[model samples]
Target: MAEDRILVTGADGFIGSHLTETLVRQGAKVRAFCLYNSFGTRGHLDRLDPEVQAKIEFFTGDIRDSGSARAAVQGCDTVLHLAALIAIPYSYAAPESYVDTNVKGTLNLLSAAKELGVKKFVHTSTSEVYGTAQYVPIDEKHPLNAQSPYAATKVGADQMAIAFQRSFGLAVAVIRPFNTFGPRQSARAVLPTIITQIASGKNEIRLGNLKATRDFCYVKDTVAGFIAVMRSEQAVGEVTNIGSDFEVSIGDAADIIAELMGRKISIRVDEERLRPDASEVERLWAATDKAKALTDWRPQYAGREGFQRGLTETIAWFKDPRNLAGYDPSRYQV
Candidate 1:
């Protein structure tokens, strides 16, 4: 894949940043599509090593803009669409914004790719789209129930991406990953919220519902799945899950993290941190059989291994005074 042209939208975000770096390492000529901002921030892309930054072409624009999305997709062999508002709590506050960005934005990308003749489009999706899981191991055939606005918009966006593939013969595959976590994950996520707080010398971790369970995958593994999907012919026009089959409740995950960090912390249920009853995705576990059968991809890291790696890297980042500036430990992010 060396020297192949690729574009990764949401390149400045948690998963997007990791995927962007992975592509660059594989010798792809990468163009990172970052969201535009007046502050001129690149998000996690700015945190990349200086050598990696030099190799990338950065395009700042909204995915909702068809013209800009078209311009970015032109001449690219693969398009990895990852840009969207991802916070479930925030989605409740502004659903219209989510629709415009996630749904309409995907529409723009699909239209652009259809027009430009992009060979493969790897659309990023979240496991939250499955809601609280009607089955233990959720498969692509599993019914979707959007419990939150965030998941609802993703469902809409994902459907549109698939529609283009079926209607126009666009080579598109949806890569739906379960909870992906690592160093650059935002504070809004449960893992980061706990890690950042504990790393900052707090003896108590304030969290929302701890009974809810999730299937967590390290960012590296999730990014690798993206590459595997992009290269596999069977993956084209398919919706495949990239995740570990196992799951852990939020409370257990917190306990595990605390143990890894050697911190004896008490968990406090924060009212402001809780998701609305209707919006909460109480359980999310994935079945990766399709991905395994199609692309020969499997998760290498289990819960303990993934958690340890995440903790070590996250602790290192949070321990740095400069790196901790953006995160506000004093206030609840949600």
Candidate 2:
């Protein structure tokens, strides 16, 4: 059998860039679909090693454009759709953009993949769909509650992937990862927000809800889960959760980060940083049994060990002036 030819949308973003690098290292021919920008920027893809960058075929386009989406999918055996508006606070301010990018963009990819007879379509989803987690350890069968416009759009996109699988017999699999964090993550995310602030040598760390719990997965492990899902024949038309299955409250996580950095910092709750009462997701804990059963995927990094390892790497990156230049630790990132 020949190596799979893959198209990774949002290949310039945090998780997408890492996934793209891994796919290239694994000997898969990768076509990276980065958003078209006036400056010809490739987001975090520019941070990748020169050799890894050399191996990828960069395709600059927008997912919302049907022509771009179709062109990106053409002649690719597999399509991993990761493009979207992911920031919750930004989603609250601009819901129409989320619907356009997450919903409509996904529709375009599905249509193109189906039309071109792509062998596998891996749709990226988020644990945010299970808002607040009605029950502990959210399973694949758990109900989806869109607490924010971002989550709502993802829910719509995920259902559309399923619709294509059933309605058009398209080979599609959905991977819902919970709070993936590591290097190249934007400050909008809690982990990066905290890490950047700490690395800036701030005496007080400004943050929002400390009580909100999350199941954090290291980016590398999350990327491995995506590959496992792609390789598993049993994962087609299925939704799998990629997570560490370990929950950590925002407050506790901040403390851990401080310890890992060997810095003593005070946590100050910033009113401006808090989400709307109703929109805030109080808790999220993923159940990975289905993913393990279907894809034989188990997280290599779990619990405190994983959290420390991931945070250490993230802190080291942020401490460097070069990597730190892109972020503003003083401002509250939306």
Task: Evaluate all candidate structures by whole-model CA lDDT and list the values in order.
Answer: 0.89, 0.93
Best by lDDT: 2
Q: lDDT of candidate 1 vs native?
A: 0.89
CA lDDT, candidate 1, residue 53: 96
Report the C-alpha lDDT of model 2 over 1-334, residue by residue, as the tens digit.
1377899999999999999999888888999999999999999899888999999999999999999999999989999989999999999899999999999999999999999999999999999999988898999999999999999999999999999999999999999999999989999999989888888888799999999999999999999999999998899999999999699999999999998888899999999889899999999998999999998789988887877887788888888899888999999888
Per-model tally of clashing residue pairs: 0, 0
What are the per-residue Cα lDDT tens digits for candidate 1 across 1-334? 7757899999999899999998898789999999999999998999999999999999999988988889888888889999999988888899999999999999998999898888999998899989998888889999899998899999999999999999999999999999988877889998888888887889988999999999988777788899999999999989999887678899998998888788899999999988889888888888999999999687876556765675577677766888777788768886
TM-scores for candidates 1 onward, in order: 0.97, 0.98
Residue pairs with clashing backbones, model 1 = none
